[model samples]
Target: MIKTLLFDFGDVFINLDKAATFRELKKLGLEDFSSGMMEQNQLYEMGKISSEEFVNFYISKIPESNSKKLIIAWNSILLDFPQHRLEFLQQLKEENKYQLILLSNTNDLHISWIKENVSFFTEFKSCFDAFYLSHEINFRKPNADIYEFVLEKHQLQPNEVLFIDDTQENTEAAKSLGIHTWNIDPNTEDVVDLFSTKSELF
Candidate 1:
């Protein structure tokens, strides 16, 4: 009796070139992110640091790179949002079978870019009953606290919510808390085939 559908944003709805950012950053003379930079990334994702601070950190590291170039390189990972996925979500919303909630590990810059570029971003957002972004909530996936926050906030039973994410670690974390999950592979699995792929649960 799944009463809720919890979804991830990137690699689930919108396409992403996961390696694009690193590739772009390499052009800016950043060969790799040090441990501190990785920590800063998580901090930025959780909204602990402002976007200005984020860009400044990169600029400080790569003196030759300007703010504009750093921002562009950071956003290079985001690609397209296919229309068919939106239609499938719209149909699901119309059916009103289960509560749809979007739980995404996203930062401010990425979201701002989507808002400006994705024409149907508003419509896509409207489909969800509750939308939770990592930066807004100060909680990112693969963290038990974030899952607990969502479950507690929604007053949902862990067993009744199906969490879908492209990352195995995220899905596994949810599953540990008694939630159902689909550890989808973006390379082969399309979210539009949810029912067919997880038929028994449906």
Candidate 2:
């Protein structure tokens, strides 16, 4: 039986712009056009450094950009939380029908930004039996080891866990481990749609 429902935070709970950072970088003149600096980001997510350090690193790469503006743009992926999704997750939590877990590959600054801006961060987070972040666990998505960490740590059966993520590669990684997955397209699928589809799975 499926006893756990694992959700990805970014697109599942909150909305984010995929291109916001790229646009912001152009404005800041980052010079290096690498996609999302995932390496440095992984370091920050692992709790190896502070958000200030992460922001400063990016700022230093920009020659004469406003640090504050660059910081905000870098954080622009975090958008407003849609109410229906929160309500759905809240209902699931109240029912206590499954082991709810939230797993996201996010970093310190992004986390700090959400903590300060998302009014329901505490309440929403409280709903999860385990809230796992790559930085916190020193693991990130698209890496099989992180999935192994969760399975081993929680003593969870991969078949019993359903992972939801906006990114296909991450979902594919989970699928490789025999975990069921839903690749949610934020521009298309809404969490409310997940209710019917997932219910059928059970």
Candidate 3:
């Protein structure tokens, strides 16, 4: 029985233009990251790298002006999170169907931007029994440990939780531990669509 719902916050809720962000950075001369940056990015997601270190590492490779421009361009991908998603989550909270927990890989800058722009963040997050973030927990997805941490922390059996994320590899990691999962593609799948479709799912 699925008693809990574990959600990933990035592309599942907020739109992420990763490809566009990297392209913008390259245009501004942040070259080193052009090839192997995701490897370093995995470190960030794993909390192996500090936000400052992550930014500085990239900035170190670019000219001063281009570095500043790259930072602006990179950070600009964080767009608005619409209220409809929040409303959907809120409705689920009202239904009291499952214990909601959110697990996300995020950083200080992305968070700071949300606090400044997404006013419903607090309310939306309140719906969750636990809200886990990589930077806050010093752990991340695609690592078996993080999945284990959540499962054990919540005393949740893998079959009792459904993990929703936009990343395939991350979902696979959760599935390895027996958790149910959904790889939400915002372009194709709306979270609201899940509630109806998943009624008889489990």
What TM-score fits each model? 0.99, 0.92, 0.90
Error of 2 at 2 (Å): 1.0
lDDT of 2: 0.84
Please write out the lDDT profile of model 1 over residues 107-178, one tens digit for every residue. Answer: 999999999999999999999999999999999989999999999999999999999999999999999999
The candidates, ranked best first by TM-score, are 1, 2, 3
**Candidate with better TM-score, 1 vs 3:** 1
Per-residue lDDT of candidate 2, residues 1-202 (tens digit): 7888989999888999878887878777865655566666667777777777877777767867766887788898788988878889889999999899888888877888999998888988888899998788888888899889889989999999999999999999999999999998888788768767677678
Identify the candidate with maximal lDDT: 1
lDDT agreement with native, every candidate: 0.97, 0.84, 0.81
Clashing pairs in 2: 45-135, 46-135
What are the RMSD figures for all models against the true structure?
A: 0.5, 1.8, 2.0
Evaluate residue 16 in candidate 2 and report its C-alpha lDDT on the 0 to 100 scale: 90
